[model samples]
Target: MVRTCFYDRISEKRIAAEALARQKLQEALDAPPAVIEPEPVAVVSLQPARNELTVAGLHLVMPQGFNFRDIDTTLEKHGHPVTFCAKRRPAPDELTLQRSVELYVENLRKNYPDVTIVRQSDRLLAGSPAIALDYIFTAGQERRHGRATSALINAVDGDERQWFSISTIINPAHAELADWLIEFDAMLDAIAAN
Candidate 1:
């Protein structure tokens, strides 16, 4: 359908610009969300560090005090061309919860063409609202794929308010625990602000 736009009486050019901007934004909002759900991988329990570990707004429950390794680094090291990776970022205090999550996913999509967005959603985490993004990516060196899940959580460092972006990835073929994927939610649920 053809639509007509009305501009302000003072400037037709300004009206056209505003209309164009609105159209672009509307198109983006109307675009289908890109969320890919790959076949589920087997899960295995990862040994937690004996003491609870905390980072970027997440308190990891590692009852056994097992040496802690970030999932992304482990993926980079586990084999050639196979990277099961996740990331944790200190969300700049300026961005709102949703914007931080969107920018993070958009950065991933822009930097890596192979990123497959598995899912994105919002949830209450640690008494604050959080956004979660689950996705998969292909490693060029090994021609292997890895699945990852990420969440953005709120925190406070003394009087300064802060936020964190937490993510995790796993190599399906090489993971140690059976049914390992199951614990991601539990872990996220356990996130506590320090």
Candidate 2:
């Protein structure tokens, strides 16, 4: 689109210069949004689980069905946001799986009240972490014997807003878990533009 700016300076040259400036401004405004490419973030793995789930120097030895509510509650009390993982029994088919993951997402939405859920298929692809924003919580479930895992990494921003990756899951296992952590950190770093 073309735009024009007029100056009442009786000089034709001044009016012409202002008009050219306006034209350039209009061109810039008409341009599309800049495509932002995420730069790689250096990710370090959590020390081996040894006898428990360890990350960020915290060693948690919790049983199956154990929700890390204590850790989350404490973080909330202290004014820091916390994100933690929760697991559920797998559904036998895609429709059921979708419902199951959606229920889980809704639970996260209701309970945490301050975190965001990033859902993906429970399947652990050959690649470390497959990042996609899809409704299907876990992919390749039938191929993987119905086993799936989720992870939540919580942190606070400078403004003290409770941010969430609360309902996100990574496939369980030492290597895949580690890789997921690394990639997740990269994803978060990219999101943060850090």
Candidate 3:
């Protein structure tokens, strides 16, 4: 009988211990979850600093990565390079902007047999009348995209007329083409004949 009572007491204690463990587990499962805080992020701007420079008697502003070459007649961006060239000279007699653009495209086609004109239109650059042309061509094994803007402006003294052509060329597959175009448009907007 003593052995039976001792066994009963142990079974009761075991049951009580199991019940306590289950109660503790249930309480833990019902409790709210802990939340973690997120780390802060740093903000950075993608636009580069702009600088004002004159090229081929045309005053304009360009991003800081561009370097002047060919006696300040050409501007070239270093990384993902884009080339810009400008030429100013005496206006040709009886040469209209349309004819000039046609002749320019004709010359380009002669040089690059695979040249394709993508767009051509009349536009304004820095409030001055201009003809804008966009074209694509294969140079050797790589494809190239280009834009040319031609305009006529009075000389600084306002007594003589001069014609100017500003051209830019780059690879269409460049990863930064969109950004480069934005910068290019900004530069065109800032152009002024000097």
Q: TM-score winner among the candidates? A: 3
Best by lDDT: 3
Give the per-residue lDDT digits (tens) of candidate 2, residues 88-116. 23223233334544655576456445434
Q: List residue ranges in candidate 3 displaced over 4 A.
A: 1-78
Range of the 10 consecutive residues with the lowest summed lDDT in candidate 3: 41-50
Each candidate's lDDT (Cα)?
A: 0.54, 0.38, 0.70
Query: For model 3, how does the per-residue alpha-carbon lDDT over 44-156 read when each residue is reduced to its tens digit?
Result: 11111233554579988765786322222334555666777765556666877787788888989899989999998887654557898989999889899888887665544
Which model, 1 or 3, shows the larger lDDT?
3
Clash totals for all models, in order? 16, 9, 0
Better of 1 and 2 by lDDT: 1
lDDT at position 125, candidate 1: 48
The candidates, ranked best first by lDDT, are 3, 1, 2
